[model samples]
Target: MSFFDRFKNPKTAEEKKRIRQERLLLILSGVLLGISFPPFPFPFSLLAFVAFIPFLLVIERRETLLTLNKATYLMSFVFSLITLYWVGSWQPESDPFLMAGGIALLLAYPCVMLIASTLYYLSGKIFPKKINLWFFPVYWVLTEYLLTLTDIHFPWILLGHGQVKFLAFIQAADIIGTFGLSLVVFYINVFLYKAFSNYKNNNRYSVNYLVAGVSIFLLFVVYGLIRISSIELPNRKVRVGLIQPDINPWKKWGTGSLDKMVDDYLSLSQQAVDSGAQIIFWPETALPVYLMGGNYQNEVDKIYSFLEKNKVTLLSGMPDIQYYFNKEDAPADAKFNKSTNSYYTAYNALIELTPGTRNYKRYGKMKLVPLGEHVPFSEEFSFLADIFKWGVGLGGWNIGKDTLVFKVPVENNLGKDTISVSGLICFESVFPIFVAAFVQRGAEFIAVVTNDSWYGNSSGPYQHKDFAILRAVENRRSVVRAANGGISCIINPLGEIEAETKMFTKDVLVGDVVLNKEKTFYTEHPKIVTAIISIFSLWVVGINILLFIKKKFDL
Candidate 1:
């Protein structure tokens, strides 16, 4: 029968029953995947290993590309909605635009997932039946990698991230990175799905496939155990303090006076200092205003004074601005200021303020949150910036150009020494390779500053904190995260949480973080795994297209 014939005719009872089963299975797959995400607890994440089996079963039954993609969209749609429902900050005090953006993301993410399913369908058309099912992982990995390159990129739900709770299973990330873990997960799903299908058909090789899948999983577990048991962190440690002020996101922007906020942060830092903190870190936008914009000299002086008195370094997130009188000297996307008759750009930036030196280092945030920070493709379609801005004035920020590794000098009882650390401003921590670049450059440890209060006490904040575990494991670097309104914590090189702060509380955490001078295999060769998978995905597409050309022209 033709593909359209079944739809054109009335459905039979058996066919209707089969359709119902497929729908239920797809929904189950999505739910399993969603609940398997981080902050859900440990054994829950184990479901990720088998989450795709039901989805794959549906794919196997669908013969046409349209049917296959429709199933793909349905399953991924449920998955996206369940896991990313918190993106919009759907709270009474949340901005309407922020909520709207969140809804839009849930709707659009399924479409992005469809890219992989559609490519997999296309590959099945060219490859032999036995060889086609294995291409799903390559296509999915390629899609995830490609998302990192786009303007509206959000690789938030990369499959490997789900396995963070399985500490022993993920220690391999140091060598393969998250992408490799994702590959392992996908292949295991494929093997298990194949085994189940064969068993139902009474095939003899069912047990072989099941054993292969289980064996591969245990192999990684054993490797993780060995790495964790034998791994040695450096003796060199830096005593650091993280401050969570529990500030309300809405009030801090316009209503709160800059001086009062600075004072509050200083008071919190004083507490951390009293605990013997050599260096203090505050959450993102600790100072919402431009501290060095020449208008807030008093506030700047007060911060420097505190730094000098306490004999410590203060690193915090602040809004930074740059001005250009000549149009040629400004970037093409620089904003125009009519009052000043100049082009100026604003940044969501980080600054380092040390006690005795007036010279401070700054790093503008590079990986911006789309719609939340800046509109994607706003460079060409600048009007989108004005239309899609967040209600709290966080919607339009210029992308930073340079990657900076801050050199912090601290004095201990032994002597005065300098250490290098990478500062990730909010959403930048989610990018594995991006974080690795800082380690490759010279950063001995990772410090993240963020304000997740906009999302309130939702899964967004918790999930955001857990991703730091992967970064820590992948680079073998200790991570210190300071968040406004909670979940501030420190993670060691082994992906273990050393110290943590609860959500929605004003708190201070102090911990000694290890400083590693050596780079991990993943850090040194960040792109190797993803690059290889991308090439194979390209070959799949290239081969499929060539076969189509040959069949169409009889060549």
Candidate 2:
């Protein structure tokens, strides 16, 4: 039968009614999931608690595995389309064919959600009796955790991220990370589903399920309240300056005057320094040109001299190049220029220019945006680069191997103290564990440099900033974000925005940021929760495999 024929006419009247009900339920779940994210009118975060219940009900009632898979994929695809449609707004003028942007907005997240849903369904089937309701949360958490380990890592619509605006309930992230929040939300959905299912069949609800769900949710709220109240700002404060240049990403490389851009940055830096800013920050690729390249020596000298004269350290994002003697000696994924016959690696780096020193410390960006910065698995499948090269004009970049931290001298009331700053370049701020790793390695404050101009005035920048707040709460470190075209702000350890800038504005924000060194439970043991879930998931998969073999062979 054709694809539509199966859904167009059912075998019986009862089957037709069942299919209609299933469609409504799946659509309801998808809409609920979508509105839970930012840019939606209301922050109805409560919807997240029961968003997946409809899908769960659909899965449980499915007569065939193929039907279940198709239903799950449709639900997930709808959810992805609603929440991540802003991705399609990225450089549409450049991508007339919409191939690259389409993959990002339409294809990527749906595929991820489909994989997650499949695992969840499989886990349910494997432990039908013992783990009917419990497996969903575990499988979902495992799926999110594994996404972090991949090259095309996009954890934007993680269930926990939906609760960012509801700060009071998400403080548990400081201890357990966002995966824990996902577990909490999914468990509540499972409990509610069970309670309602029991009520439908027996005309009575399961008191245990209701109690468990309510109690766990209340526990998170209580913990959040206590945690927010307990946090005290550190005594040592660093006066940091953030510059938002509002450069148009499309014309930034070719059309705009390079000299004029540098002058604008210098003017802003001077304004920030005059306001008694101890350390100044610039957005990602603020310099526009490769600072390390020979062409920009005069511009580099100007910046260095300004830093030396003001006695203030300047941390700016710029493009960097590292040339290799031999193509084989370069990183496995390093791009080669056929024209230059040179092997080189390009980086979106944070350069720290200290007073009285030409020698600058650099932190190369590690977690790159999949197609924007580097195509995934381009090294293994070289043709993928040509296929996915539409949006940014730049090809795949070499991944940075080290987690480097810079020590900036901050003069506080007590004496001169040093604040260890960790750099998160552009999309790197979205990863929870990646930021936590820097904190564990002696980073006192996190600095994010990004250029969100490509997103325009869409929900993309807002969502990006929301992820940074979670990172701050997770690691209990203050975040200083510098975005090229807006939303630059300083977020406190309690997930509060201390200072901010509007989108598409050239502005300078100077704020007193508390330099904190104390690490949270999450920082000390970042992957402990994920490790436990992964181990259990593997065991469940093993059991499922054995059960399948036994049933197939008639054992």
Candidate 3:
């Protein structure tokens, strides 16, 4: 029968009722997961623990993988729409290409989710035992981790991100990372589903499942409390200033705005320096033009003059260009400049300038925002670049090859030393593994520079700010975030926000952030944790496939 024919008419009243209940359960699961995210109040995140139970119950009654996947896809779509609706920047000035990308993500993310459900369904069919449900966490977490490894990656809805408001509960991120938290949440939901199923069947053992689920939760909370209490932040500190210029992101790229933009940054840096700030941070793309690309020498001199006058180090996110004079030095994909007869590329990058240091340190942003910053598989299908260009000219940034740490000299009443810091530009902050890589490389603190103004007064900025909290906890390093329109703040090693600015406001946040040279267990051994999880996921799926082959082929 055709896929649509199955839904045309139910043969009996009981079947119709079951179908209606399944649809409601799927929607319920989606709504629970959606409202649990940021921009909602605290305690809402608790809903995430039980969110998957309803969906699992629906999966239990479905016999065919096709029907089960279809149900899972709709549930995922509802969740994605709620969490990622602001990605397209649906304003009057928004680029059509940007909007198109956003819509595509909402549609495609659900299809990606089908991988986990299919695994679960097949495992259950092969195992023919209730024990198969216990592997759901592994299947789900593997999918979340796999999403982080690709160019079209968007790990925005990782289950652990929902617990950002519950600080004490998330302290364990230092040891396990966000993906581990996802595993824990998924297990709890599976147990709860088991308890509910057993209770409906009048089994007294339902209490055991309930107790098992609650016990894991309580154990995690106890561990979190102990961890949060035992955390002793480093004594060394640096007073950093975050400049939120509140510039209209769309208008800044137009003609005659470069001078004013630089002036605004200098003016804000002066305020921070006057307040005794040793380091000043500017938001992403602070200078829309290439300030160091030979043509903007005058602007470069102005920035240098201000840094020298204040004796303060300035780290800002901006567009960086590199021209390869030698043909052999250029990558095959490098754009050719006909006027100069040279090959070059542009990057969304962070540059650090210190007083008396003519050579600035720079780190190009590695994780590009899918279609907004780059086209996925552009290298394999080169024509994609021609069709996916954004009107604002930010659609084609070359990926950065290296992760760099900035070394800044600091001096105060007690002593002087060079602090090692790593900068994450824009969406690079979302990947847990990516953030921890910098910590493993000896970064004492983390700096994030972003332009959240494009989305404007939405949950995107708020959610972006909160994700930094997990990074702080995971790496046990302070996170200092500077955004164009606000939510600029400092997050300590314990995932606490020290100071923050309001959205769409032009302001400066000056706060003392700790400099910690220590790395967390998660930072040191992320591979081990993810490897074990991946092994279990693959082991179960591999067994299921082998079993099916043996049964069908009589091998």
| Candidate 2 similarity to native, TM-score | 0.94
- TM values, all candidates: 0.97, 0.94, 0.97
Sort the predicted structures by TM-score, highest score first.
1, 3, 2
What lDDT is reached at residue 462 by model 3?
91
- What is the lDDT of every predicted structure here? 0.90, 0.82, 0.88
lDDT of 2 at 465: 86
Q: Point to the candidate with the largest lDDT.
A: 1
lDDT of 2 by residue, 107-158 (tens): 6566665555566656677666336557767877777777777777877788
lDDT value for model 3: 0.88
Compared with the true structure, model 3 gives a TM-score of 0.97
If both were scored by TM-score, which would come out higher, candidate 1 or candidate 3? 1
Ranking by lDDT: 1, 3, 2
lDDT of 3 by residue, 85-108 (tens): 988889998888888888998899
